[model samples]
Target: MESLIDKDRIQVKFSAENQFAAIEMAAKPLWEQGYVDEGFLAAVMERERNFPTGLPTRVGVALPHTEAKYVIKEGISILTLDKPVLFAGMGNPKEKVLVEILFLLAIKNPAKQLGVLQTIITIIQNEMVLKKIKGAKDPKTIYNLINQFI
Candidate 1:
């Protein structure tokens, strides 16, 4: 299987006004590269609104994703924000977290979703990795760092 973390799919110091914009920015590469279907973005945005994926880790990370039907090929789109954006907390939607990173997931294969999420969660839990990602000036650095965990 091809690696899900493509260097080109990673963006560093990405600027977005809000979480929705951040999700759009992060997911764009996947959609453009045919990793996801045309309606994927809409589905992801809708899912995000209903069941927020923002987690309160050492550094907040948002996992915006939808059902498998929207994915053409499984892939992960990564974005390290220029500024943290507000997203409803995963555990409690009433609370908000300032998300510094966005992991936009496109999973065509349902069985692999849990494994993928767990790997990304491992990355999110490591402050050193999050710091490295935050300080990264280029996508190659982020890609390699994330590839290691994957």
Candidate 2:
């Protein structure tokens, strides 16, 4: 779980002007920890522009990620915002969603990305888990919830 979810890297009640800043905020720790390259943030921003990762799940989350080229190590950066941020819905440019959670993925292995994403999707789709996340007051609680699932 340390490799996937760095407890210290988790952000609770995170604030940002927009999704791009939120992504930069989320990716900072991973970058400082040597998990991702300098290009990680830029690549993610470009990817989001061309193809949004926002999901209209039970909790309204976004899964922003880029190619393995931007990754030095595999990890997931979770940010639970203080307020919901609007993001273009995935595969639906016309639609917009207020996302409270962001999962910024930095995966060095392309083959493992799908499985990891699927696991996260499964977690996000679970009503109980979504409830727990939305109700969580701090990073420890959120981290604990993920630990339970993982």
For candidate 1, report its TM-score: 0.96
Off by over 4 Å in 1: none
lDDT of 2 at 110: 74
- Supply candidate 2's per-residue lDDT for 124: 93
TM-score of each: 0.96, 0.94
Candidate 2 local lDDT, 1-150, one digit each (tens): 446987777888878899888889989888999999888899999999999988988778999999998888788888888888989999897789888898899887777887788788878989788778867878788888887767
Tens digits of per-residue lDDT for model 1, 29-122: 9988999988999999999999999998878889999999988888889999989999999979998999998989998777788888888888
lDDT of 2: 0.86
Q: What is the clash tally of candidate 2? A: 0
| Off by more than 4 A, model 2 | none
Please state the error at residue 13 of candidate 2 in Å: 0.3
Alpha-carbon shift of residue 50 in model 1 (angstroms): 0.6
